[model samples]
Target: MTLFFLPIPVNSPLPDLTLADILERTIELSQTAAVILKSYYRGSPAQLEVIDKAEGPVTVADKAVDRHLLDGIQAMCGDSCGYLTEETYQAGDFQLPQDWVWIIDPLDGTRDFIDKTGEYAIHIALTYQHRPVLAVVAIPESDRLYAAIAGGGTWNITADGVRTPIRVTGGKELTKLVVVASRNHRSEGLVKLLAQLPCQQQLKIGSIGCKIAAILEDRADLYVSLSGTSAPKDWDLAAPELMLIEAGGKFTRQDGSLLKYNQGDVNQWGCLIASSGEWHQQILDACLD
Candidate 1:
């Protein structure tokens, strides 16, 4: 029943908040999510577990960190905007405010987290008027984070705190492409689709945002998802969508349609592809065939 947003300021001078500031703060929140997740990981195994209404396992780390990130954003951005999150927002009860909104997934790869595979990540994306303008994807176990500020470009922070710019590699052929697919969400349709391709390699990773991060780093060439009746949530791809586009990559639905956010339905069903821009459409067509 609680609506989320930044409070409208009447008298106080507006802070000179920029996309960079938002990105920096989002990274900080991601680190916070990391700490929370790590705490659960190191705690008594029996105590850090949970079960959601959908019968999905919701570990202590997941809910705790989800609250932490949501609270963190609320504290920073206040009541002027709205919030949409994987763990908190109910589709029927909430509608996005007209101003800025946040789309978040506190623990994206929950299954991987439960298994302690270190492939999970926390996703934080900022949307203005329903389109992502700033985003952050943090992989705590690996000590890596990827961020983008609308036009600010994509950046990577190494485990040691070193920062580097990231971009998709240009002009790679389909035969030599290295695709990164979802570790747990892969569909039989996608497997059959890829089987027809002459791709050189594929890496199955957890989290859509995390997979996009791989593409941003050029570690893997592409990230593809074949959706079923249930589409991906807005929180699921909002950040990755902008981050990948700003990183000079292509992100679109399986049929090559552009993605739009704040559609009420969070799930993004259908074929989805993220590539370094050069061969994005080629991969889409191949998958469709």
Candidate 2:
């Protein structure tokens, strides 16, 4: 793994901040997080200690990793940007300056991480004027990095500095679609609804970000999260949404609504879907019905 230190000069000129630069900084933080996470992998009883917050299960690794990324973003952007994160902010803390905002999930697949499944990742995104312009999703265990810059394209940054463009598949029929569902975050109603879909296969993965990564990489054709009270938050979906969008995919609520951020309510209460746009409307219509 490359050194987890950021090298971007804060004194660089504005408008010259490339997507590559943003992704580089994101990867830097994620790589740092990877090191922290590896220390707790298959942890001892002491390391496995869990704290039950009202939101859900949070581990020592989650808090530690979040702190790492939070400090990283602070250093990378300084005080010029506003921040929103699952681990750091509350509903009323959405106030910000006008330049840029960062939506982050320092660790996106907490359950998978706790279970030692090697499926979790660090999610980071830079939003410009309420729209995501750059995103990076780093899978620590796999040492793989996936990133995108709006209109700049998506790539898998390898350990040796190689970058490869990623594209989603265009499957023609709903019956041929492969759906990636939530591993620890699904409901009975969603299960029944998925069963009724024309899906040819269903994959259970951890994290909304990971499921979206599945679609962005063509590993699966779609990902659907249908829930009311337990809906996803902007931090959970924002980074992956940007990556999937830049990779030529689409994402929205079940009612075909846009995913907006910093709404004071972190829990985005609605049906969420990410697909290659081919069978997206089909799934969306089914969920609506």
Writing each residue's lDDT as its tens digit, candidate 2 over 146-247 gives 877766677888777787888777945678788898778778878877887778498888877778877776788888777754777778888888788877
Q: Could you give candidate 1's per-residue lDDT for residues 56-174 as a string of tens digits?
A: 46777877888899888888788766788888876573457555788898888788887777888888888876678778888888788887766667777776667777777877767
Which consecutive 10 residues in model 2 have the weakest lDDT in total? 4-13
TM-score per prediction, in order, is 0.88, 0.88
- Quote the RMSD, in angstroms, for model 2: 4.3
Q: In candidate 2, residue 99 scores what lDDT?
A: 47
Note each model's CA RMSD in angstroms: 5.6, 4.3
Candidate 2, pairs of clashing residues? none
**Stretches of candidate 1 exceeding 4 Å from the true structure:** 1-15, 52-55, 91-94
Q: How many residue pairs clash per model?
A: 21, 0
